[model samples]
Target: MILDALFFLIQAGLTLFFWAILIAAILSLLTGFGILDTRNRFVWALSDFFYRVTEPAMRPVRNRLPNFGNVDLSPLVVMLLVQACMLLVGAIRGYMIRGGLYF
Candidate 1:
């Protein structure tokens, strides 16, 4: 029972992280296109929040990746990695449920 709850929490957190990376990417594009103005306090705060939430995960990936000039691929890469982690977590939970291992 506890393992199931733990797995659910892990999956939920990974899902949130996945969406954060996605939103940060979309916000960047909008700001770049002038559709979103950082001068507006609300827009700036939202952008800042997502940036803070996603940057730590993205920084190493950004550093290792070759520069794409104006385009950033780190968010996409990070989202993909987060998706993989979610899948792995589900698989592990299934395996454990099947009596494969115990935590």
Candidate 2:
């Protein structure tokens, strides 16, 4: 029972993390394209927060990747990695359930 609950909690966390990364990626693109202006303080703060949170993981990837004539692909790569992590977490949860490792 306890193990099952723990697995559920982890899955929930991973889902939230995945969604956050997706949102951050979208926001970054919108800001870059000037489609989503941060005139409001709230928008500014949200964009700033997301950039800070995701930049560390993205910086290394950006440095290694070649820019395609003003197009930045770092956010896409980061989103892919985030999705991969979510898939891995789901697979582990499924394996635990199928193997009867959790009660």
Best by lDDT: 1
lDDT (C-alpha) at residue 58 in model 2: 83
Instruction: Name the runs in model 1 displaced over 4 angstroms.
Output: 100-103
> For candidate 1, lDDT tens digit of each residue in 1-103?
6787788899999999998889999999999999999999999999999999999999999999999899899998998899899989888887886895755
Candidate 2 TM-score over all chains jointly: 0.73
> What's the CA error at residue 46 for candidate 2, in Å?
1.1
Writing each residue's lDDT as its tens digit, candidate 2 over 17-83 gives 6666677888878887998889978889998887777788789999999878777788778778877
Local distance difference test values of all predictions, in order? 0.92, 0.79
Residue ranges of candidate 2 with Cα displaced over 4 Å? none
lDDT at 5, model 2: 80
